[model samples]
Target: MSDVGDCLFCKIIAGEIPSKKVYEDDSTYAFADIQPKAKVHVLIVPKRHYATVAELAQNDPAELSHIVGVAKSIADDAFHGAYRLVFNTGEDAGQSVFHVHAHVLTGEVLAE
Candidate 1:
């Protein structure tokens, strides 16, 4: 697998940084967010070194879909209810990590 030298998500997926993994496959890796916005917040990251979803979508559309698929399945199984899939494209959009990832957020308010 290719890795960006300073990418935090890469480090996490590489097992150098500790993370609570929710799901993992050849193409994607899902783990709990350290700074969660909701009670159940997980980050689904692509193993490849795409800086943003737009990049992933343009270069590897199938991998992008796989990330979303994993996000859907993990969110459904973990929350057993509705969840939000969020992609922050840039720093202004609240993307602290540059690695391409989708955030799965399930909230009590969503169920209400």
Candidate 2:
């Protein structure tokens, strides 16, 4: 796990930083991405900070699954459950934020 104090997603979850919230629950927070790649792009992050999806999975599989559930719910509301869930594990993979998050992208036909 990474230091939650410096994690951007953690700060958003803590209300230290403002975000366009889409959904929130006891274990997850979903918000609009500042730089969206799709028409409906939301980031679903766990309240507990984990540096990567692998880290989150190793520590708590249920939490990781919960994030997916959140993503599915977001898609269901936005575009009839048609969406893509993505996780960029490393910096090289375009994971700008260190905290693990699922990108919920929908509202259009995404490219393969």
Candidate 3:
């Protein structure tokens, strides 16, 4: 997928906006959520813009794997090896942000 010209996540990765970053590499970045939904809420995003998980999955397998791998490490550190990781796929799934990201949420168990 091609980059979105004005995606907020892209801007964040470019240091255009302030974010509490946890991890960063050439292809991905993980950061603390501005409005966290859990005691530990972090968003792991790709440095390159992809509008949705499907897009990322279809177009960039290597980058996607790296992104998830980094997210796992973040989750392990944040929750000490226990946490729930989520991806809001599209608008109907509560994906307010168009940027593709994985949500590592933990601290308190959210009843399934």
Task: Name the best candidate (by lDDT).
Answer: 2
TM-score against native, each model: 0.90, 0.95, 0.89
- Model 3 shows how many backbone clashes? 0
lDDT of each: 0.85, 0.91, 0.84
In model 2, state the lDDT of residue 85: 94
lDDT of model 3 at position 1: 31
For candidate 1, which ten residues in a row score worst on lDDT?
103-112
Per residue, candidate 2 scores C-alpha lDDT tens digits across 10-75 of 899999999999999999899999999999999999998889999999999999999988888889
Model 1 agreement with the true structure over 69-96: per-residue lDDT tens digits: 8877876786776788899988888777
Model 1 stretches with alpha carbons more than 4 Å out: 1-3
Model 1: lDDT equals 0.85
Per-residue lDDT of candidate 3, residues 21-106 (tens digit): 88988888999999998898889998878888888999998988897788678767767767777888878988887989999887
The lDDT ranking, best first, is 2, 1, 3
